[model samples]
Target: MKEYIDRKEAISAIREYRGYFQDQKSTDMMLLKMEAENILKDLETFDIVPVVHGKWIYTGKEMWRCNNCDNEIAGYDKMPSEYGVNYCDRCGAKMDEVEE
Candidate 1:
């Protein structure tokens, strides 16, 4: 049977693999790179800050919210193309044309 792990377990597994790579002499570079990429993707999904240009940047995935009612619309890519001009469902206020 296949096993499933929660986010915490997944993150822990990634960290453990990284440590193993550091200690082992015969490391698989391609597998290490793939794991690194997976770790980054998981971190982003949890709204964790990621390293950028050698620095940990405090930026999460961009989210949209209704200006008038403070209702959460959706994250950047999930938003509709016409969301900029749409009205808020809760308050009937026009959506903000500009992203913060």
Candidate 2:
């Protein structure tokens, strides 16, 4: 399961994790260290709060646009989700009408 945490909480957890490695060593530790640092860097660049969110609105005969980003998305007459798209490919906004 994934836990959503604020910056302070995440920082605290990372610090605690660093402390746990003070005395442990594994043959694969060196290999994983770089990957772990990359993961942390990726976390640091993440947007905890999304800036774009909304649904696709039918704009014309076969055109649909994301209300949040105002970009065209390809889909049939049904909701984009009917075609297995649960997000705005252009803006990364979830296609759900409500946020979880």
RMSD of each: 15.8, 9.2
Q: What tens digits encode model 1's per-residue C-alpha lDDT throughout 46-85? A: 3433222111111336555654456555555544334353
Give candidate 2 regions above 4 Å deviation: 7-52, 98-100
Q: After superposition, how far is residue 93 of candidate 2 from its true place, in Å?
A: 0.5
lDDT of 2: 0.67
lDDT of each: 0.50, 0.67
* Candidate 1: regions farther than 4 A off: 1-62, 78-85, 96-100
Best by lDDT: 2
Each model's number of backbone clashes?
0, 0
Which candidate leads the pack in TM-score? 2
**What tens-digit string does per-residue lDDT give for candidate 2 at 29-87?**
54456565556657744456644557878887667788788988754787777788778
